[model samples]
Target: MEQKHGTPIEWLMPLAFCTVFGWVVWHTPAFILDFGPENQQLAALYARLDVSPGLAPLFGGYGDIIDYGALLLSPLIFIGGVMTVRRAPMEFESWRAIDRVAVFIGRITMMLIVLLTSVMIYEVILRYVFEAPTLWANELSLWLAGFVFLLAGLYAMQQRSHIRIFLLYDAVPRWLQRVFDVVSTSLIVIFAAALIYGGYGEAFAKFMRWETFGTAFDPPIPATLKIMVLVIIALVAIQAVINLISDWNAVPVVHTAADDIDQDELERLKAAVGNEGVGELDVTRGAIQGNQSEHK
Candidate 1:
């Protein structure tokens, strides 16, 4: 089966969602003032909290909604993007150890962020509407989000989706590309290994301390789970390194024989022909002959 590369839109969806979610979270107070003052649920909560009148306007009922909505949507978007890419025709290529590790870390982080954001959004909404919320949600979201941020490097490595100038890279000899791949992958592996070692201690310490959110919904969810994400990230980072090594020593492979033509070139061809889909060259010949006879 051919692996399908994700369309730009698919890749961008999670990014777009994260940006919007971040914006909403960052500006929750402002949004409340502008659009949510009329929400009775929010007003009542504000009143009960003994919040001053000046500050009351800053609280919005939709804070949870926005927060949770972003969280919920993020993972779905990520999953969708991954599945889309997975379906693309897979092409084997050589990669640097650093590059593979980076891609792996990047993928894991992306998934974690999306999932954590979703969990946060869910907890916030449940708390506001039902007068109850899950302790697990908060802790889960925090741990998951933390891992997501940490795993970014590994994911980037595995996917080989890191940003590069394809035009320049493509122009280079295959042997050189292989060399660059080795150098890049080696650096990534070293960096990720260091992060894993340092991160492990911090994660273990937190677990031992028995950290809790200190909210009504607080639960004794182990900090180890959060730390485990880093461990997994480390593994992914290593895997990426292995992948890079494998690719580095192998010859570069190209799956398709066709040239990649840009939209501009396609459009230029259309313009020259005056209309799109003129069909075979034989069809053009027939049309020209028909026009010539009509003139005669």
Candidate 2:
């Protein structure tokens, strides 16, 4: 398969992610600084509950502006993220910009999963082997894992890999399939909209207060995750819309038990099993391929 090459713009997504997360990891405390003890004027701006003296100047008195700016420019971010995944082979022929963006975020989410696993492993080693477990590891793992679950949903939606009963769907005509698609997408949109409407106030309050998970190594899981929930659901809704639009004209697909098998995964397993194990693998693979063809 010929790979689609992206332009210089493709670098924007990764660079943007690095910059955001890097800033977040480093300047988190700084953003919630309380300069009131030393400077009265700066205190008014940085005033918040549970704040301490820190490097507030790093944000140059425009932290909120920068955040709002990013929100306004999210469409560009979406385009950049989409472009980042264009070089790879796509599983869906109907994949569009939103699908690419979902996949890109999903890839990032996968990296976070690795980091989460590493954190757990380190915690285990310290608790058992050294008996000096860190205070932050468990909380950090929970934080990362939560986002992973949220983001993986977007990827699953794009890949159509989420759990679904396609028995009725597969038997439907093209027009009925389109109706189903529209109805499902509308429901998704409504759910997201309702969630955001109901939760935005609380999310905004927590974010403004810069709430933290009260622990020895206090982390702002509450504040960040509250906002994250709304953001992710919005993204998922956008993806659902894009999926409906992109797949509107696509040929109706038949789903079966064979659809549960991943050919690529079978190939990987076969490769890893080697020549001695090839016989049984060949039989299973051949059967799967035939079933796939028969379903088609």
Q: Highest TM-score: give the candidate number.
A: 2
lDDT per residue, candidate 2, 1-296, as tens digits? 12564455445565566345644532343344422124443344334421333433334542454443444455566565655565356455565544667777876676677778888999999999999999989898888888788888888887777788888887878999899999999999999999999999999777666667878766778888898899999988998888888888886665556565677887787789865686544445357557678999
Off by over 4 Å in 1: 1-139, 147-156, 165-168, 219-222, 249-296
In angstroms, give how far residue 60 of model 1 lies from its true place: 50
Candidate 2 segments whose C-alpha is farther than 4 A from its true place: 1-22, 25-82, 87-90, 264-296
lDDT of 1 by residue, 157-192 (tens): 455545544555556888888777777767766876
lDDT of each: 0.53, 0.69
lDDT of 1 at 140: 59
How good is model 2 by TM-score? Answer: 0.72
Report RMSD (Å) for each prediction in the order shown: 16.6, 6.2
Model 1 CA lDDT for position 233: 60
Model 1 poorest ten-residue lDDT run: 49-58
